[model samples]
Target: MHSDVIKISDKDIKKPKGKVFVVYFSSISNNTHRFMDKLDVSDARIPYELNQELIVDKEYVLITPTYAGGGGDTKGAVPAQVIKFLNNENNRHLCRGVIASGNTNFGDTFAIAGPIISKKLNVPLLYQFELLGTQNDVESIRKILEDFWGEK
Candidate 1:
């Protein structure tokens, strides 16, 4: 069976309506942090910082990694800290979408955090990539962000 993934180039990605905030957590392998670096844009912050002040406005995308267990035995779920940060009612409105990361070894549970966040937060699960991601993954993510943030 062929993968149904569509290949999008950097040229295809458009400019944003405004700024796009990338919120991520990198506690374990830090692969998600590495992936964010490849994006090469500066509008990013950690969840802890945002919690200090309720950000009721602005467009943001969550980029987080799935933990081995959801702080316990539930594998492939969003970490507790991330959930706490997002739980703030004010922060919920600012989130436009999500991009999740996980290890492929997790199999079907890989990057499951993205789906949970997207559903609970009422946003789209923009992308889910393996740890650190690949060159194509970076470019594709750029395109998705650009398109999502474009005039609309």
Candidate 2:
């Protein structure tokens, strides 16, 4: 088998209408970078910041590592930061899809980011992947993406 799984709601994972943006916000050295490497990109938030008010008419999937208070719920609630970003965009209709990625331990952290992404932007969580990071993080990621997009 060349597949995997992540629990998601019905609202998430819609086939987007236009071009897609794979936005990644990384802090912990290479985890974020390594993950992004396994995927293809039409465009990326490499600078990880967007032009103010540039409503992306294309679909988007966000992959961000959970940090700050640390893994899942420190009860720290930094998920609001993502909401703030969406609020700043003020273009809910522009987002046709949503996704998040983080270490498997902080499962709830990124999981929480999903609904908030939906509520804040009124979008949907297309899917999310949590990595415990085995001996081969790259291969783990490749398997997951292969499962999701059925590409490479």
In the range 92-125, model 1's lDDT, one tens digit per residue, is 7677778888777766567778877876776767
The best candidate by TM-score is: 1
Candidate 1 positional error at 99, Å: 0.6
lDDT of candidate 2 over 11-113, digit per residue (tens): 5655454443565555446566666666545545433334433344455556554443344353433234344455545434556445555544444454455
Residue 11 displacement in candidate 2 (angstroms): 8.8
The per-prediction tally of clashing pairs is 0, 4
Quantify all predictions' global Cα lDDT against the true fold.
Answer: 0.69, 0.49
The ten-residue window of minimal lDDT in model 2 covers: 1-10
Candidate 2 stretches with Cα past 4 Å from truth are 1-15, 28-30, 46-57, 68-84, 90-92, 107-110, 131-152
* Reference-based lDDT, residue 138, model 1: 95
- lDDT of model 1 at residue 81? 67
